[model samples]
Target: MNNYKEKQLEKSAEHYAKKVFKVIAAIVFGAIVFGLAIYVLMRLWNWLTPELWGWSTLTYWQALGLFVLAKIIFGFGGEGACKPKKGKKNKKKWKMKCDMRNDFSDWKLYDEFWTVEGEAAFKRYIENHKKRHHENEQKQS
Candidate 1:
């Protein structure tokens, strides 16, 4: 009836209001953190640069600009920068290239490989390289 409909409408309004509050809170918190970072950066630059490098000190806006520029150039690293992706067949390949882990699981048999077949392979490569160089010299002459 009418009462049931009003209750449903109230619940929906409350849910949306909570969501909007969370969004506003997040934006405000982000702004505060950003402002604090810029202030700290400006203070540090003003303290250090004038003394060490005889460089000009930065204002808050200048510090903010520099921070943005540095982020743009060096990248804005965030969460999961090195975290492995799920359901990925290339996780091993990605981990191999990531700087997070120095593990060489595949290279565990490197010594055995070198002892068994690496020397012969290297010698063959050297012989091939020498032949190629000699052929190039002959061609040039």
Candidate 2:
């Protein structure tokens, strides 16, 4: 029983070591690629800036810093492109909202009608609404 436990522990330790090594290798590789990218950006800046705008040629570190600065200011990977994950519930909600806005006229409300809560409200109204013509007939009777 003790021998079996020892083998299991050795296997687990080897697995853990492999995972750590892989993580370290990925980090090193990422750093190398980032360094190369920075160098490329620096070369392009050097080639263009001094000739076009009378700007001084940047050093390696300056170029890296500029890259970092641009990334910070302009940003990378903005949330503007994010799409909500579609699900059956969302589809149902969209249909409900569409039904509720049968007489949509306002442009601002049109935008609001497409939102989740507005869609929900639209759905609720659709489900509960008594036909206006039906109510009128009963009133006349």
Candidate 3:
């Protein structure tokens, strides 16, 4: 009975190990394919934009700089092209407060000017307004 249990445990362990290996293999394969696609795209872009690629206009170092800049601007990997190092402060601080109109018609002017915190504030304001309105209706009834 002990021998059977040990064999079953070993089989289970081997099955889990195979799963882990498969996952790692898939991740590596995905990375390689993604890298190849990026390389192909960059090559095509360079070929098409001859003015942006010439040695006189952009040396090796300049080309690298431009590539880095483009990556920063476009956010190639979705979240950001490059992650900031630990302990490094982000230099760009968005202005939180702006001249926001109190009237509902002018709400559109402030639509793009809000931070996440500001959005929460606005939502809370709306909720409070609705609650007050409901309370007033209850009092009237």
What lDDT is obtained when candidate 1 is compared to the true structure? Answer: 0.90
Q: Which candidate should be chosen as best, given lDDT against the real structure?
A: 1
Against the reference, the lDDT scores of all candidates come to 0.90, 0.82, 0.68
**What TM-score, to 2 decimals, does candidate 3 have?**
0.38
Measured over all alpha carbons after superposition, the RMSD of each candidate to the real structure, in angstroms, is 4.8, 14.0, 17.5
How close is every model to the real structure, measured as TM-score? 0.68, 0.55, 0.38
Q: After superposition, how far is residue 77 of candidate 2 from its true place, in Å?
A: 1.8
- Per residue, candidate 1 scores C-alpha lDDT tens digits across 1-141 of 999999999999999999999999999999999999999999999999999999999988999999999999999876455566567677767777675465668688999999999999999999999999999999999
Candidate 1 or 2, higher lDDT?
1
The weakest ten consecutive residues by lDDT in model 3 span: 93-102
Once superposed on the true structure, which residue ranges of model 2 sit more than 4 Å away at CA? 78-141
Please name the candidate that would achieve the greatest TM-score relative to the true structure: 1
What stretches of model 1 exceed 4 Å from their correct place?
81-131
TM-score head-to-head 1 vs 3, winner: 1
lDDT digits (tens) for residues 1-141 of candidate 3: 999999999999999999999999999999798566566656666666676655233344455566678789976674332334455465332111111322367667675668746788889999999999999999999
Worst 10 residues of 1 by lDDT: 79-88
